[model samples]
Target: MPEAHGTDEVSDARPGPIRVVIADDHALYRQGMAIVVELDGAAVVVGQAGNGGEVVDLCARLHPDVVLMDVRMPVVGGIEATSRLHAADPRIRILMLTMSDDESDLFEAIKAGASGYLLKDLPGEEVADAIRRVHDGQAIIPPGMAATLLQEFSRLSQAGSVPEGPEPTTLTDREVEVLRHVARGMVNREVADALGIAENTVKNHVRSILEKLHLHSRVEAAVYAHQQRLVPPDA
Candidate 1:
C-alpha cells in the first residue's frame, strides 16, 4: 500500500511537498520511483498508474504537482497522456522519465507540454532533484540529450520551408550572450562572472528568455538556439 502524508491547509505554504503520480508500464519501475519520491522528504508519490488512460484519469482526480511518466505504455503512451493532461489543465507539469533517450521521444514529449525529460538510469537522488526543479516551474533535460534534441530540430528546420511572416521573438543581445555561454555548458555563476553581471540578473534574463520562446528551461533554450543555427554546430 502507498504511504500517506498529512494534508495540511496553508495558503502560503512553501510549495508543499511536490505531489507526484508515477506512470510506467513496469510495476517494478513504478514502485522504485515511488520509493525515490518518498525518500526525498520534499516529494510525495500520491498515486501510480500503468497506462495512459489511467494517467489522464488520475491527473483529473489527484491534481498532482508532477507526473513521472514513461515514454511507452500499454493503452496510451506518455506523449498522448501528457497531451491529454495538459489540455485538461495547462498548469499541470509533466516530466517524462524513460529508459530510451531517443531524439524523437524527447521532441514529441516537449511538444506535448512535458516540463522535464530525464532518463530512468538517473540516480534516485537526481530524480528527486529533477522533480523539485520541475515543480518550481523549471524544465529538466539531461546533459548530452540537448545535443540530440538540437540535431533533430536542425533536421526538421532544413526539411521544411520557412513561412513568410513575423518570426518568433529573438533573444536580446545580452540574452544571446548568456545563452551562448549556456550552450557551452556553463552554470549560472560561471555565466554571471564571465558576463560581468550579477547572478540574479543572469537568472532574470533566463526567465525572460524562457517566457519569450515559450520554452521551459535553459536546456530547451540552448537546444532551440542550436536548432535555429544561432550558435555554430561545432561551437
Candidate 2:
C-alpha cells in the first residue's frame, strides 16, 4: 500500500495541469485514485482528504479545478460537502465518484450542486476523461444512467413539483436540433460536427438551452426532452 499522505496541501502550480483533489475515505482507494489521475499527465492531484469534512476543508484551501468526491463518508458525506462548497463558491465544479447507483443518491447529488456523477467501477481513463469534461463545464453521467434520471424527473413531475422558478422559455428551432443530438448522448464536439458547426458554438447552444429550460445538466436536458416527447424514442 502506498503511504497515506497526511492532510497537508499538495500544490501543483504548473501552467498546464488541471489541479484536482481526491476525497475518499478509503486509503487504498485514495492511493489508486492518485495513480489514475496522474496517469493522464495533464491532471495533478493537489490534495487527498479521507472524509467529507476534510473534503470541504481541502477544497476551501486548495481551490482545485475539479474535486473527485466519494458520496458515502463518515463526517459530512459527499452531498453535504458538495452543497457547502458550491455555496461558498459556485464556480467550484464537483464530480461525484461513488459505488452506488441508487436513484435517490443520484438525485440528491445533483440537487446538492454536483456537476457530474459517475460510478467507481468506470475505467481509469474514462474517469480521467470525465474530470476533464466536468472541468470544462460539461455535466457527466455514466452511460445507462440516463434512464434512471428520466424516471426521477417523471416522479418529480407527477408529484406536482415544478422547477424552482417559472418554466423557462422554449428552445429555438436550431437549439432543438442540437438538443435532439444531445438527447442521443452526443458530446459537444460530436454535436457540432454533426451540425457542421464549431464546437464552441455547440457549447453556447447547450448553455443557452440549459438556461432557457432551467435544467441542470445535459442529462437533465436530455431527460426533459424525452419526457416532453421533444425527441421520440426512435428518433
Candidate 3:
C-alpha cells in the first residue's frame, strides 16, 4: 500500500497543471521526480506509489491525467500495471520513465498501452516537458529507442503475426487525415500546421480519434493507422 505523501493538496480534476501520479520502487527517486516535474508548474504530482498495485489503486481514486510509471516494480510490475490501467481507462496517459534500455521492456510498455516510453538519463527539464507532450497526446520515444521500436515492428511483420487487414476501424476522412500524420510521427503542432487548423483543434481531433478508435496513445494510434494502410506506402 503506497502512500501519496509530500504532494500538493490540489483537487483531482483541475484546469491548471497536468495531474500526475508517480510510481517507482524508490522513495528518493519518486520524491526527486515529483520535485522536478512540478518545478515549472506544467505538471503536478497528485499521488505517489512504489508498486504496480499501488499505482493502479491510486489512479483509480486520483484519476490523474498522466502517470509517470517505472518499468520494473515489485508486487505488480509496470507492464501489468500499465495493461490494467489502460484496460480500465484509455484516456489516462501513461509514460514509462525508467533506467532500463531493454527493447523488450519498450515494446511491452507500448503493447501494454503506455502512451510513451522514456529513459531516466534525460535531463529533468526534458522529462518535465515529456509529461506535457504525453498529456497533449504525443508519443515520446527517444531517438535510439525509436529505431528499436521500428525493429520490433519489423520483427513482428516478418513473423507473419501482423494481420493483413488487422481489424475494422470507423475513422472519418478528417480523422484519417490526422491519423496518417500521427503515424508519420508528427506532433500536434505539426499536424495542425499541415492541416491548416489550430493546435488546440488538432488536440480535440486527436482526443476524438482516440476515443472513437478505442486507442490510448498516439503511438497506438500510429500502429493502428499503419495496420490499416492509412499512411503513404513509404511510411
TM-score of each: 0.81, 0.78, 0.75
Highest-TM-score candidate: 1
| Clashing residue pairs in candidate 1 (N, C-alpha, C atoms within 3 angstroms) | none
Model 1 lDDT tens row, 34-79: 9988896988889999999999998899988889888889889889
**Compared with the true structure, what per-residue lDDT tens digits does model 3 show for residues 1-235?**
1111110011123367899999999999999999999999888899999999999999999898999999999999999999999899777888897775554788878788777676777678788877876675566677556656755764675577644432535767787898888778777788899999998787777877777776656656666676676765468
**lDDT of candidate model 2 versus the reference:** 0.74
Off by over 4 Å in 2: 1-15, 101-104, 162-171, 180-200, 212-215, 223-235
Q: CA lDDT of each candidate?
A: 0.73, 0.74, 0.75
Candidate numbers, best TM-score first, in rank order? 1, 2, 3
How many steric overlaps are in each model, in order? Answer: 0, 0, 0
lDDT per residue as tens, model 2, 165-184 = 32324678899898888777
User: Residue 93 lDDT in model 1?
Assistant: 75
Ranking by lDDT: 3, 2, 1
Please identify model 3 stretches exceeding 4 Å from their true place. 1-14, 100-102, 157-182, 186-212, 229-234
